[model samples]
Target: MIWIAIRMLTGDRQKYYGLIFGIAFSTLLITQQLTIFVNLVERGASGTYNVPNADVWVMDGVSRTTDVNYPMPSTALDRVRSVPGVEWAVPHLRASASVRSGDGDLEGVSIIGVDDATLIGLPRNMVEGSADVLSQPDSVIIDDVGVTRLFEDGRSPIGERLELNDQRAVIRGIADAVPGFTSQVTLYTKYSQALRYVPGTRNRLSFVLVGAADNVSADELARRIHEQTGLRARTRDQFARDGIEFIVRNTGIPLNFGITVGLGFIVGVAIVGLTFSLFIRDNIKQFGALKAIGVTNAKIRAMVSAQAGLVGFTGYGLGVIGTMLFIWGFSANPFFKGFYIPWQIPLVSLAAVMLILALTGWLALRNVLKTEPASVFR
Candidate 1:
């Protein structure tokens, strides 16, 4: 029965192809937009992710995210270090500075200052040169994303000189760091060097990166630091979530992507519904003939379901493949770097595809179910 139904569906190649295309197009749009959206929002946590070693982030009470932070007095580091569960605490500086590139064009860049002795705040991996290069005089490391922005002509930024706040900064290395939410160019230097590069303020410390003692969990350490110092202390994961939430609350990205996903659902329903209805209308006599034979309405329902299942499976697979190809093709683009479709996104798309098939199939089935056995004589 299912085989016969599939053959009937395939008999009309135009409608058959149209149905599949509709499902596939909708799946691709929904999945692709969702993948990009997730990746973009996740960039809000990139600063925290780049500094892989920190267990706790101690900052001023008013500071919300790594980027949207209020500077704290240098003594804040001492207060966090005094906390019992803290094994080590270092001063971390994150500030924005305008730099005069080698070409004399002024560009805004984020300055990250890692511990001078431990380099704990630098990214775990370096794309070029060694982390030890920061030991060189007037040295700073540029992130890989920054490399493309600062040197657009495919020229190497290594040894490139920039003027920041009347101080010379030599690009000594390239850090394999995640791009920030704004895809801002980031330069990492020793804490002391960053202090000189960025315009001086009364409170120079932006955050105190802390390592919890082996016996203490990050959460416990965070609570202890917060209780003792009356400062904002967040575990690494909590701080990352904070950054992500801040972006979601502040930006229109969620609403924009949501509207796009809704449109995909609507488009799928429109195309698939119209084509399926036409298919059922043209094949009315066949359905009536089957009813006249031993085939019951229950059997007829199964046949239609089999057809819908086939279309949904084929279309869903093709759409997901198309999305994967799109991501792979643009992987080299700085903006699309590190983009990945989460596991749950595909599951959500699958549910959407099934809903589309069920809705359209149910509507198209009404006429077939109501057909009288004698209607075939007409």
Candidate 2:
């Protein structure tokens, strides 16, 4: 039956060839776009600014991890220490402000401040400078990309002493991390520097980052801290999941943005279906001849299904190759610095596309089976 179906479809080379390529092209586009969108959302949520994998985190009264809009009073550190299973809690301040490059005018910067006591939250793998460089008063750290984006490769603005508010500061180091996947280049400074830059704020810290005792469970500790302080304390794992879910649900990503990609897939299926139907419709006489030879309706139906599957399957395979190339090339390009392609997404998404292709072939098969061989005799 499969061989018969293949022979029937290939009998008309001109008709199904264009349909084959069109379906393949559609698959390539939809798969690549969906892969990018999902990868971006996933990376953004837990990439950097991501909590270190540990027992628990101590933040302000806010329940959501990304909603660090309010300051976690510097005094929050002391209270976190008293909680059992807390090995240590690091304190830091984070906010955004404008930068004066001394080039022309001030630009925007997302300033993050951390203490020497616990810079664990950072990516820790130094691309340029040491984490401890931030220990010096008014000393700052910038990523290589950040420096280039902000001051044209640290030529003019970096290293030079500048005024951040009333306080004098110097760019001491360059670093990189995954925090805020698409966040602008930032200025990293000490807790004191952050205090000075963000004025009209309490001298207290914003949040306490707690590392739990190794022997004990983090969940128990998170529960304790949450109960005690009326503040939210989440483990690093929870934080990452919450972060991804937040972007997916609140940002209308999986529902709205993803639907467009889904439509692309449906269109691919339709194109393949129409192409098969066109050939079947055009060859009513051939089908009639097969029927006249005592071919069962079920066999004819299977033949139709096998033909659609053959074309769809061939197109789907080619689409996977093309989509992979696009994913790799686009992510590596300089223009897509903020965008990232995680390793897991492509493998999973490819599998999904294959399954969808099979389903699409099944759908188009129904139309093929409905063609009556007797129509050709009339």
Candidate 3:
């Protein structure tokens, strides 16, 4: 029966392929778009997630009290270091200045200052340059994606120098694809090198990055800091969560994707329903012949179900392949953060789509069964 179903669908492209193509493309677009959208929210949160070991982040009191970038008292950093479970503490200075390069002016760079030892929470997976580059008084590290500002031809070479804030600094090394939340073309510099661009201060940092031992909870560390010094602290994990919430709840991302996924769902049902109904009309003669050949109505219904399952499973496999190819292509683009399909999301989507297709087939099956075998003989 299965072999017959396969041969029938393979031979009847005029009847089946149109339906298959329509269903497959809808699935592919919805899956890829939704998958990329979710990943963007997660990737946007990455800078906050990188320092998983940090139990707390101490913020300076300025702007909104919740603003993470405002500078706190430098002495507050020492207070965090002395906390019982605290292993080490460092300050992170975030400054933004227009960086002048021979190529042009680049804006919204995240200039980070870290203590010589702790390095203000640099991610371990920096692709280019050594961690020691921050130790240099004027040296700075920039991600390869942002290196385009330094040279017209992006992949020019290593050690090409650029002028920032009218100050001379050497490119220590290149990191990969770390972007600022607001700007796409962004760069990074040393904490002290960044100070050269700040409005007034030359030595002070913006905020502090604190590290804690395995024994500490981020919440506990946060409380200890407030109790001792009355400063605000944050954890990397909490930052990731807040960042995602900020983008989705505070921005248009969630609303936009929600509309897209909703449309996809509606189109999916429409495609399956219309195509299967037409198929039932075309194959009515076949169903009638089986009923006349000593086949019970239940047996004929079973055959119709087998055929729908075959079409649905085949279309789904093709859709997933097409979606994966789309993902690979988008991952390489500089503006895109690559596509990631998590286990739970795609799994649930697949189940929902299949169930929808099944319901569509069942409706067509009802109409198909009612076509009297006697009418075909007449």
Predicted model with the maximum lDDT: 1
Per-residue lDDT for 163 in model 2? 56
Model 2 bad stretches (over 4 Å): 43-54, 152-163, 179-182, 252-255, 333-378
CA RMSD, predictions in order = 0.6, 3.4, 3.0
Report the lDDT tens digits of candidate 2 across residue range 127-166.
Answer: 6668887777778777555666776543744466655665
Give the deviation of candidate 2 from the true structure as CA RMSD.
3.4
Q: What TM-score goes with each of the models?
A: 0.99, 0.84, 0.87
Per residue, candidate 1 scores C-alpha lDDT tens digits across 262-328 of 9999999999999999999999899899999979999999999998998999999999999999999
Question: What would the per-residue lDDT of candidate 3 be over residues 158-224, giving only the tens digit for each residue?
Answer: 5655566677656676665444454344345555556665655433656567766788877888777
Which candidate number has the best TM-score? 1
Using lDDT as the yardstick, the better of models 2 and 3 is: 2
lDDT values of the candidates? 0.95, 0.66, 0.65
Show the colliding residue pairs in model 1. Answer: none
